[model samples]
Target: MSAFSKALRTLSAMAIALAIGVAASFTPAHADPNATLDRIKSSGVLKVPVMVGEEPGYVKDPATGNWSGFYMDWANDIAGFLGVKVQPVETTWGNLAADFQANKIDIAFGLNPNPKRGLVVDYLSVPLFTDAWAIVTKKGYEKKTWAELNDPSVRIVVQKGGTMQVVAEAMTPKAQIIPVEDRPLGVMELQANRADVMILAIFDAVQVSKQIDGQIILPKPMLINPATIGVKREDGNEGYENWLTNWINYQRSLGLAQGKLHQTFEKAGIDLSMLPPEFSF
Candidate 1:
């Protein structure tokens, strides 16, 4: 071929390659339509809001005000996936629903799913962990069975607007249910002997008992609660939600979730034997 013809052919090949690159930029094979993930990536930070004081899951150390625990580890993995830094936002259990509604935070952990919450936020399709609600009380006030807590004399303290309150009511319809602002306060009431019982998750029951000298966790649990994280309900983020659900399952598959719980139990000086069989590491 003539030199001019050869040069024209080479120019044509270059144009085709440039066109393909442009097209890929607009519609790459892996392009995700999840606005949530897009936001996290662009911002370079995954904001994970959690209850401030819950131990073995989400704890803000009093000594240094640094955050640690199960959620912290999970947040790091999520941030790694997003290629961003994890920013921990402090929140209260009573305020999580409202905070999520206001878009004050992007993620919330250790929250159980319910209809009312479903309206405002979406839960991971796969549960991150399974836990049971237990009743804590003065050592002498321990109930022998779940039925014993149904008596009219039983006054159970629960965190206001928390799922434990709903469980407490369902388990002991005739008993009085008192709402407290947070878990720490609920345990404080029990410690003072002003409250006869306080209902919480098994881990929470253990955490609360640590605050008071003689509180006992009933041998039997009041209810089983499967736990998952929460993200705001945004329209066009279904792919992002599915990705997160899968990520959680991967964590469970690798024993990362269970391992975090085990680490927490060990740090708290609690034996894994006390946890249910399914919770065994």
Candidate 2:
């Protein structure tokens, strides 16, 4: 072949190679395991666990089977931003931590971030809500700080497997701790005189106090703790942990946290101001 013809053939081959390179470059990136954002986009839903009860910061309407609470609303907002629906997994306080550890739920709402829990789960950057520990006792029982409740003769009832149990065990090592399946049961134990005091989340204690018809009273002195969403450590894929953390911060910025708390308190017929400030998170 002539030199010009040979050059022309080489040019054509190079042009084809350039086209292939451009096409390859335009191809989508490989899937990332930590890509929680992408997974939400593909799956079109965000699964979250929510407790169903009359707790001031959390509630579920029995009539519609719809959940509405401070944490639930925040979770819904996160799902909305992802253009996905929120699938709420009903859970109880006693089993919420276990469910989160077992990967049964994507996030556990209204949880406190502790070093012990950090061993198993990742906590969001912004807390969903918070509640303080309240010492619930018969009217005029008159115990001040957690230290005051540390007497060996004092029997305190706490919700089994709940954060209060952890706090009680840590703070009042000498006191007798009674663990029950639910907070109301703990309240009942207090009412029955089986327990001297009930250590409970302030919101829960407030709700139980109303139900017991002034049988239980929540005093001012209590320990405060902020609660956040708990995600399984195993789910550290696709920046899912970061996405959730950002999502919670976004809600806090929007003032949705405070608004939802007010709404939840109103629905439960409890005064929002009675809640610890951290509960507004």
Candidate 3:
């Protein structure tokens, strides 16, 4: 072949390679859409995370090694619907995403859907419940609005490394944010009078206030946050998420979720009247 003809052939080969690379770049990452559902059906168990020592949501009987709480009740309900047994996996909120990614658990409830965590797991659109940010305060420290509490002199105790901490930092930036490892430690801060305020979800605030004989205040212009379910972000997760959202909607419509919440609060010795008049499940 002539030199020009050979050069032309080479150019055609390069163009074809470039076109193939472009096509490959536009292709989506492969995922199994029905992977989670199929696994659950085959295994005959729905793996769910159950927090140890967490009341209202999860409680364990040391004597019988059995779990009972609103969360377990809901888990059992979901499993029953799927014709499977619920296998509880003890985990913490911070470790849930990791557990889901590692395939250690199949689903987690009561997760606050946030951007950072959304990258790792899929959250259902239907919320498990709506909870407002509230503060449990001593007798004379009631503040009507969040802005009123944003002062350097005001000391706020929040659960370390949780959403409460984030809210305290953002909403009460000028205030003192003391982060504790858990709820009990936060309660200790209040009881010892070391902290003037404790930030928590409204449901938690009511119970804690009753426990400590404090007062619950849902700051004005209430900050409403919804808790939802999180599942692993795997191929074929659409069906799983859809089914979960539908189930949640059905439960909410029938007042089953709210009924469970009421049962939990009552079992925890919390009076329904303690909740703010404006608050609803």
Reference-based lDDT, each prediction? 0.78, 0.70, 0.85
* Runs with alpha carbons beyond 4 Å of true place in candidate 3: 1-30
Predicted candidate 1 versus true structure: per-residue lDDT over 1-281, tens digit per residue: 99999999999999999999999889936444587788778998888776755887887878997788878888888889889988877777767778878878788877886777788888887778877777777667657566888889888899988888787777788988889888878877877767888888777877776667545454454356788888888765777788889988898899888888878778888766754454322
* Tens digits of per-residue lDDT for model 3, 51-94: 76366678889999889888789889989988999998977766
Shift of residue 200 alpha carbon in model 3, Å: 1.2
Error of 3 at 204 (Å): 1.6
TM-score of each: 0.82, 0.75, 0.85
Score residue 219 of candidate 1 by CA lDDT.
40
Considering TM-score, which of the candidate structures 1 and 3 is the better prediction for this target?
3
Clashes of 2: 7
- Residue pairs clashing in model 1 are none
Clashes of 1: 0
Top model by TM-score, which number?
3
Q: How many collisions between residues are there in candidate 3?
A: 4
Q: Give the TM-score of candidate 1.
A: 0.82
